[model samples]
Every structure is written in C-alpha cells, then in structure tokens.
Target: MLIDGLQCGHFNRGVFEELRAGAVSCVTITGGFWQGCIESLDAITRWRDLARENADLVVLVRDAEDIDRARAEGKTAIIVGFQNTNLFDSRIRFVELFQDLGVRVVQLTYNNQNEYGGSCYEPEDSGLSRAGKVMVREMNEHGILIDLSHVGELTSQQVIEHSDKPVAITHANPASVIPHKRNKTDKTLALLKERRGIIGCASYRNICAPEHAESAEKWAEIVARTVDLVGIDHVGIGTDRSHGHTLADMHWMRMGRWTREIDYGAGSPENPGTTAPLDWFTEVRHIGRIPGALGNIGFSPDEVEAICFGNWRRVYGEVFPGGK
Candidate 1:
C-alpha cells in the first residue's frame, strides 16, 4: 500500500504518479511541517488543487471508511497529516482550521523545541508545555491523531497519560536497538503499546546507524526489533523518505543546529554526518528491497504484510472515517 507521512512542496507530482501505478494503496500525506500559518494554508490549497486535477488517481480520504472504499474501488487514498505543530503557532483554533482542510495526524514539535513542547533533540527535554497539553486535548476532541515521533521523551510520556485516545509515533525506532535520540526507548514503546498506540517504523537513512550507508536489510532489522519489542498489531511503516531532496534538504532540516545552536545535550546527535545525497531521491527501487531483508530475518509473508501496510490500514480506520 501507499505508506507515507509527509509530501510537501514540488515532490507531490512524482509521488502521485507512483501511487497511480499501484506502487502503494494509501498515503498519510503530510502538509504541515515546521510551517507557519500562512505557509500551511498555501500548502493545503495547492494539495486541494492537485487532488482536483488528479481525481482519477487520487481520492481525498478523511476517515477509515474512505480508505476501505478506495481499496475496494482500486483508487489511492490520501490521509492528510502534519509533522510539527508550528503551523498552529500555539493557537488552538488553528487545529480546527487544519481539520477542516483534512489534516488528520499532527506531531507536536519538530527537532527543536517550540511553544508546545521540547523536541527530542532539545537539551533538557522539558516535556509538553501548557500549550502542548491544550493542543493534545484539542486534537483528541477533534479526532485528530497526535504523533510523538520527534517529540521529547517526557512530553511523549505526558501525552500518553493525558490524551484519552490512542496517540501515534509516526516514525521512530526502538532506542534499545539503535540508541538514537530520535528513537523511543523500550519502556516508552511498551507504554505506548499498553495504551493501544501505534509505532510507525521510519525508513530514513539517519534513523539507521552509520547513516551514510544503510541498506534495506538494515532497515528490516530495525523493523524486526521493533516488532519483537512491540506486538505486530501495533507496528506500521512510516518510511520517512524525503525523496527529491538533497543534503541541502538535510541542512535545512538541521536549520543551522549543526553549528551547535540548540544542543540536544543528552546523547550524541542521531546519525551524525550520515545525510544521504540527492542521488538517493531517484532510487525508489530500494523500497522493494525491504521484503528481501525481511526474508533474511525469517519473517513470514503474513507478518511482513502487517508491517508493510495492513497495520497502517487498521489504525487509519480507527482514526478517520470517510475522511471525517
């Protein structure tokens, strides 16, 4: 199926083409990531226009019901999402605006602290702020999924306790396996699973060790570890592939933080100096390598299927119904 987290800027066209070719079934299309209100609005508008033009290949899905219907009709469904709450800018009302525009999942922060809470990369990891608590409640009330992939540890814990509904870690690893700041510890993973939350395994190279040279086998190994730690039902694919971008993109993600502006201060930088080159963008062929890697790990097709897309379908169904 089409498993995705965010598709912003000019990369939407190629992504849509892939989906049309049956490359995947559904995509959790992320629109907001570190974008201010104006930027988020503009991005959503562009996505709407694109959806209209590609109506044959794309169906705007707001709920789990639409995903089921789209799969039955052989059309690709797009689930809108956000990687950071910077779009809200600490204003709770914007959650409704984003919900109106079809955003379903939202991460509380990026790699740095924002008004809502500290990022996983923050030095102190102060957890969710007062505004973040409000944001979580608002998201729950509106049926928007709260994603904690890049959020600080304390904040992630607080969100699990505070939010009534199941939260999500859209893209993260098991810290016990890889020991990266971006990864969740085994205890955190267990807690989230206990709460019936979902943990999406990211395919981004950095999340893997020795960042510059990680293969699909390495990714599968990580996935297996996560599945072993957490149950198969709670796991899914996030991929986190920023296809069509370059090291320039990585630098932009760093936002000059590589210069030590905001130190995470706890452990070493997650996958330091392991940024993938622009050439990686054109090589979608690597995606299929995952199945082979899973084979090496001795996972049956049924288990692989769950990790690849089945688990995501189950979770998406619970979150959005007919693009609600």
Candidate 2:
C-alpha cells in the first residue's frame, strides 16, 4: 500500500478521492502549519468531520496497526499531524493534550525561532532551547513523533541526540541533493542514520527541483540518491502538496501569524509565491506511479517496497507503541 508522509490539501471528498485514486493506504495530512492551539484544535475538528464524512474511504489512524487494518480493508488511514510546535508553545503540558486529540507528528519549529528552537531559515540559529528539551522529553513520554523538517541544523542535531526513541524528518531532502533551506545537512543525516530514523523526500516544487522537472523519473532519482546517502530504511514519501489550496493559503504557510511582512519561503519578494508541488503528482493517484520509476532506476523490489511504505510502517511501530 502506498503512503504519503505529509500533505496540506483542500481537505474534502475530492482530496480523499485523489488519495484512493493514488491507491494510498495510509497518509499523514497536516493539521497545522503554524497555527496556535485554538486554531489547531479547530483544524483538527474540521479534518475529523471531513474524514468521518468519507469514513467509507478512510479512517483516522491512531496506532501502528491501524495502517495495516486500513490497507487490508482497501481504505486509507488518515494520520492527523502538525508541522510546528507553537500550538503548545510555552505550555509543555499541551503536548499530551494535542496527542490525545490525535496528533501523531509535530515538527519542532517552523521557519524561525519559537519557544522550542531555531529554524533552518534563521541567520543565527541558537539551536534548541531549555523549553525545547522539556518538550522533547514530554513528547517522548507520550509517544509523539518529533519532526525536524523545518528545524535548524544545530537544533535538529540536538533533538536526534536527545530523544530516546527514533525521531522522524517527515518531509525534507538532503541539502547536498538540493541546496534548499528545508533540506537537511550531512551531519544531521549521519545522526539520523545512526538513530535508524526515517525521512520523507519532500515533493514541494522548489525543494525537489529548482527547474521544476517534477516528473516521476526526477523524483525517483532524488529518492534513489537520498537512499544511497542515508540507507534505505530511513527514506519514505512526504510529497508536500497544495492541490486545491488558494494563493492565500499557500501564502499563509509562508507567512504565519508572527510575520507582518510577507514571508516568501523558497521564493523571493519579487516572486512571492512558491510553485505547485509536482507536475506528476497533481492528483494523488500519481503517487502510485513512483514504484515503477524506482524499479527502472535499479531499486530492487525490497528496497522499493521499503521506500514506498515499509519504512514508515517501521517508524510507526517504533514511535507510537500500544496505539499511543
């Protein structure tokens, strides 16, 4: 069964339809980018209703076994997730509250310094804070998977070193592969490999290819290269999508509540908007097309299977024990 590691979609029947068309058995959709606690709760509520509306097609995944169960039934297991830590910002206790609400993954920081730590985009990254350390331990105790996708290099290193369990870089590529800020460093990848952690090759247009090749072949090449660098068990799919979002919605991901000025992530002030995700993956069904490309690129069936969804399954079992 195919699984998308992360996506920010329009969230409706149309999205679920795309997911099924892609033959996705499990997925982790964004519940927040930079939303506060109340907004995040509202986002979860909205998505809960939407998932329930399409109950026949998908179910909210709260455990490792839910993924297999959904796939067995020919349905997609939707894992509600977060991309930033500000929802619980200063309140360490809120991590459990959000976990109770079905948030399986939480990126420690977004694009700048937060209560947790510095972001990759920051010019002077101070790394993880005192509060950030507490948050990590708290999340560990509660089994919330820590995501370091948008976190600073130093901070990402710290989290990987600090967490007793394996963490996930749910969506990000190797910076050597693509020089984007969102991409990670060799040091971080080394630590990740040491921890037997997992990473998702982000399919966001700018991060994947500056020229926007956006083909299944191009994406397959990226994944293969990443696997070569970090080993097979650590890579998966996290095709960041904006299939049905508006310009404003895209802008919101770039500029959250903290920024009064327009923050053009992976874009410029002149070109203040990020491009579409991937040309080949405009429809969710396009994810099903990746395995064949992998096969073409000399990825063995087992390796391809690991990249497709197996690694993520292993991560789920490692991070979320006993249904979390």
Candidate 3:
C-alpha cells in the first residue's frame, strides 16, 4: 500500500501510467491554490475528467476505503486537495460543497497570509482568526482533513489546539533538520504527535538540506530522524513531486496573482527559476524506490510499511470516517 501524501502532478494518461509503474496505491494531488470558486470547480472538473478517462489506472478517493479498494484493484486512488482556502474565501458553507465534490484535504494557508491565518512566509504570525475557527469547525463536521504544510507557526499551533480532530502537516519536513521556514520546529512536531497527528516528510529540495537534496541515503536519514522524534505511527511520505510541470508553472505557484514581480521561493536573483529536482526522484515513478531506502536506514519491514502508507491510512480513516 504505497501512498504519496502530497503531489501536484499534471495528471494525464502518461502520468497515471507512471503512478501505476511506481505501484502507488493512493496519492493526494492539489486541486487549487489562490483560485476562486469557479476556477477551483473547473479544476475539480478537470480532475474528474482525467479520472474518468484513466479509470483503468486511477479512481477518485472519497474515503479511506477508496484507498484500500484502489490497491486491491491495482489502481491508484486520487484524493483531490487544495493548498489554500482561497477557493471559498469567507464562505464557510463551501466546505461541505467541496467535500461533496471529492476534495478530501485542504491547507489553511499557502505561502502567504489569508483570511484564515498567517503563512510561513509572512513576517508576523497572526494566529487563526475568528473566521478561521469557524472554517476549521466546518471542515471537521464535514470530514475534510486540515493541512498546515505552509501555515505559520502561531496559527499552526492554534489550529492544533482548536481542531477536535487530529490535523496533518501534509508535506513539510522538520525545521530542526533543515532550518527552513517552511519546515516545522521540533516543538510543533512534538505537539502534533501529542495530538496523535501525522507529519508527511516532504521530498521537496527547497525545504531539505542542500547537500542532501540529491542523496537518497541522506534523505532517508531525515526520515529516520523524524521517526525518532515522532514515532513511526505518525510519519509518512509527501514527495511534493511536480512531474510534467515547467518553470512557468513554478512561477505561477510562487507568485499566484499576489505580486506583479516574480517571487522566487527558496531561490535567489541569480538562479531565478524552479528548485532542482531530487536526483533520486526526478519523476513520480521514482517514489517506488523510497521503501527500500527506508529499509536500508534501519527501519524494520513493519516500520517501513507504516511510513510508506499505513500511517496515512490511519489518519485518513479517522478524518474521513467510513466515507461518511
């Protein structure tokens, strides 16, 4: 049951074929970021069309059972997600609407602050707002897993304390390991584990140590350190793989209509482009090799299974709840 907790692939028949080749049982793919309701709906429609066209390779996942079904049928399960709450703005009712549309996970904030709360890139961390609290409750009631991968520290902590259900840091690493703002601190990770939450170790290079960006062994070390910090039950994989995307797509993600100028995230003036791909995992199919890497890093077979998929399955089951 290999699962990727987060990815932003441009899914088509070829990409779906790659997922099959990788033996991925399930994957959570982004549906929108900084998109209004109409655009978000259009994105969802496109995803649905893709799944329909590639039904032989993938199926839309509405709950944890769908993940198991996909694996049993040898097809990859697709969980549509959003990296921002921009789709609905202040309209809390859209939570249930999107859930009905097959969106299973959503991040509170993206790279910048919004009505929900501050983001990792924001200067001051304004904790979750009143509207944010309402939104969180709505999502809980509706069975949508809250994600804090790009949210700021203060807001992330408040969300962890406020939400009745356990949340997820879907695609971020430990700040102590890489010292990136996008990564979580040791204190936050401890709090997440205390709440029985899960953290998906992201394979994105910008949030990882520079020397380790291309080394599977070093990356596995990062995963081992996270497992040591928060037991294997709370750890999983989120490759953040953007296969089939180009530099233009990267620019759109970073500067999503917020700034007129190009915002090179984790990059500088000299190298104003997308971050380098991981040497070991330049494509989605390469994710299949991660289990071996984890095993080589002293993880037992059971532990490897947990990190690869079982842990995500547990969290998704708790949040999705028998498909509601």
RMSD of each: 3.6, 1.5, 1.3
Q: What TM-score should be assigned to candidate 1?
A: 0.86
For lDDT, candidate 1 versus 2, the one ahead is 2
The residue ranges of model 2 lying beyond 4 angstroms of the native Cα positions read 210-214
Using TM-score, give the best candidate's number. 3
* TM-score for each predicted model, relative to the true structure: 0.86, 0.96, 0.97
Off by over 4 Å in 1: 5-9, 20-22, 210-215, 256-274, 277-282, 289-292, 321-324
What residue pairs clash in candidate 3, if any at all?
none
Model 3 per-residue lDDT tens digits across residues 24-107:
999999997788899999999999898999899999998889998899999999999999998775688888898999889999
- Candidate numbers sorted by lDDT from highest down: 3, 2, 1
After TM-score superposition, what is the CA distance of residue 4 in candidate 3 from its true location, in Å? 0.6
Better of 1 and 3 by lDDT: 3
As a whole number from 0 to 100, the lDDT of residue 76 in candidate 2 is 92
Note the Cα lDDT for every prediction shown.
Answer: 0.71, 0.84, 0.88
Output the number of the lDDT-best candidate: 3
Candidate 1 local lDDT, 190-228, one digit each (tens):
888888788887765556665324556656777787888
Error of 2 at 113 (Å): 0.7
Error of 2 at 238 (Å): 0.8
Angstrom error at residue 216, model 2: 0.6
Candidate 3 weakest lDDT stretch, 10 residues: 209-218
